[model samples]
Target: MTSRVPRRLYLTIVAGALIMSVAMGIRQSFGLVLGPGAVEWGLSLSTLALAIALHNLVWGLAQPVAGAMADRYGATPVVLVGAIALAAGLALTALLPGLWAAMLGTGVLVGIGLSCTTFGTVLTAVGRAASPERRTAMMGLASAIGSIGSATVVPLSQFMIEADGVATAVTNLAMAMLVAAPLAFAFLATDREATQAPATLTRQLSLGEALKEAAGHRGYILLTLGFFTCGFQLAFFAVHFPSYLVTCHLPVSVGAAALAVYGASNTFGSWFCGQLGTWYRPQYVLAWIYIVRGLAIVALVFLPKTELVALGFAGVLGLLGLGTVPLTSGLIARIFGTGNLGMLFGLCFLNHQIGSFMGAWAGGWLFERTGSFDPIWLATAAAGGIAALLHFPIRDEPVARPALA
Candidate 1:
């Protein structure tokens, strides 16, 4: 089955990557608006935090269903629905004044949209389309390129919020998201169609059996547990880091600038990890990334807060921001086979999203209670250490091809 990928498939992957870039990039910038949005809307940080927290939880909860649907039906329809929902959610958040309304808009609609557009559906489509030998590398390229949106959009969003206000900024993002509606057509039905053929190895395992096999594996459990740290750490910073900097007496520009830096830096990390995953055992690479992230957090917590230091911290975070994704998702493809990659990877991401809820909500809750971020920082550091240990024991061997055939 090993063969050269056609030019059209490469174009499809690029379009898919851009689709993810727009979806995830805009979501990452929510933190840029949270502080201003709370002030403008007469809402408390904790209330807004809870909204984002709920968003993560909902995204996780919906991912498996979305993935399963993609596996059964196809990705195009799923993506089309997501693009519409995301646009509508943004429009609602921009127009509505009520907190609960905003929650439904930002928290619920965007969350479900994310489930369909992001890794669960898009990456799975690409994974199944690719040869097994090229799957991880393609995932890496797509995921890494997705970081570009964050790099450009974060600073741009901040600028738009400053010039036009929060509502207009969000509305602009909403309009931009509609681009995905057209891009959704790029995911041809052929790959998913090929899998449905009776004689193919991809057709052997039912969704239920695929899930059962993964659940029974010890390595899968460890991988799931370890992924919690990725969510926890990212969500904490994504939601609270700017405010945390504000508390440090830094200018708001510094916060936005730092996010831009983080986004820019992550591009390299994402690319490197993608390339590294092709050659190395992804588990080891994943392990080192966690350990290094933990150490970086230690430095950020202990070091004095200055504009330069703040930017440096963001740089470190950016470098590690999405670096783990390729390794983790690639590992899932290797272990479980690609037939049910969407649903299986969705389950893994669900764990990450669970941690995401706690991270975003807890930062606000704890800051409200204690009036400081020290505890949140400390907890993230410890979680990183824990994740580093979890990957060590993962059974990295691929499942037997004959078993499915």
Candidate 2:
């Protein structure tokens, strides 16, 4: 049954979506910049890899804190700050000296910016605005929109790289971030409805207590382990896919098309995850997704390098790739309630980013060292299988409340 949607809720979802897309687009554009930046700065692949590693690390670590802030305050000011930081980071990357400064601007600065603005922050706001019944669907819609940013920006970035130059492309990306600021302003124009439910309260759990709680939660532990694999796989490909294509005796166009296909498929995947979750238990669905991903990766590794074949693999994988997001986030809301979701999910995301760091850095290091991506592909396939296994035993029900004293 379709839930009645509110106009303000719709606008808020759209605004949060745009913020995520713009923030993510600017970060994803790093692929287009890597080649040019390296050539201009005489930097090695490892250096660029380090910057991206740091970026993923910071982005992952900062998310829980950002979520906490947004939960306590509103999403507006935090997202606004992220938008400005994204612009500044890109601008600095365009004009910065030396590789170290580049890492600071592009990696640390941009990563933190995205941590504040991307899926977690926006999802929290959208979740808050929508009714309980509509929350998952709204989250899916927002994610689908954000996926468009990934899809559009890669090719657009490649085009800009060709038309003007990488430096100009970076500058243009900085300008693009400003667009989100206005969108944020529009979203914040309406006040969110106050929940009639009693405020879910928590006494600050010591880090030890929090960790103990998370550790005992079988699903949460599995989620953390499984999501690490997702980060590893995503980072491995996002940073190295273009270079890997070049290794396959194909044109760079193939790489760009592969990424583009992944982004496009991701939109469908994200949306589908939302729609499907309404009927199915999210944990079961996510487990199946991971299993399918393992199979897809195995197939892609053996698939021919023709443009059609490669793009097909990319599209199929893309569908499963980011689609995990909505399910993962939804599971958090289902099990932990959105009250402390920011912190809980932030901890979960830290696991994902740790994987991201390894994936991004290891892909480059291995390629530079081994001169082939074959081993990494095998690792990705294995990781997917492992993630599937991890989720198989996750308890989907909410934790029992503490008995009153």
Return the TM-score for each candidate structure: 0.96, 0.92
Model 2 segments beyond 4 Å from truth? Answer: 1-5, 186-215, 402-405
Q: What global local distance difference test value does model 2 have?
A: 0.78
Tens digit of per-residue lDDT, candidate 1, span 1-405: 234355656776787878888888888888898999998878888898998888898899999899888877778888899988988988898889569867998899989989988878887877777777887887777777878888888988999999999999999998888966678787865445644744654446788788888888999999999999999999999889899999999999998988888888878888788778889888888888888888888888899999999999889888887878777888998888777777888899999999999999999999999999988898998998899899988887877644443
- After superposition, candidate 1 runs with Cα above 4 Å error: 1-4, 189-195, 201-203, 401-405
Best by lDDT: 1
**Candidate 2: RMSD to truth:** 2.9
lDDT on C-alpha atoms for all candidate structures? 0.85, 0.78
Worst 10 residues of 1 by lDDT: 1-10
What lDDT is reached at residue 318 by model 1? Answer: 84
Give the C-alpha lDDT of model 1.
Answer: 0.85
Which pairs of residues have clashing backbones in candidate 2? none
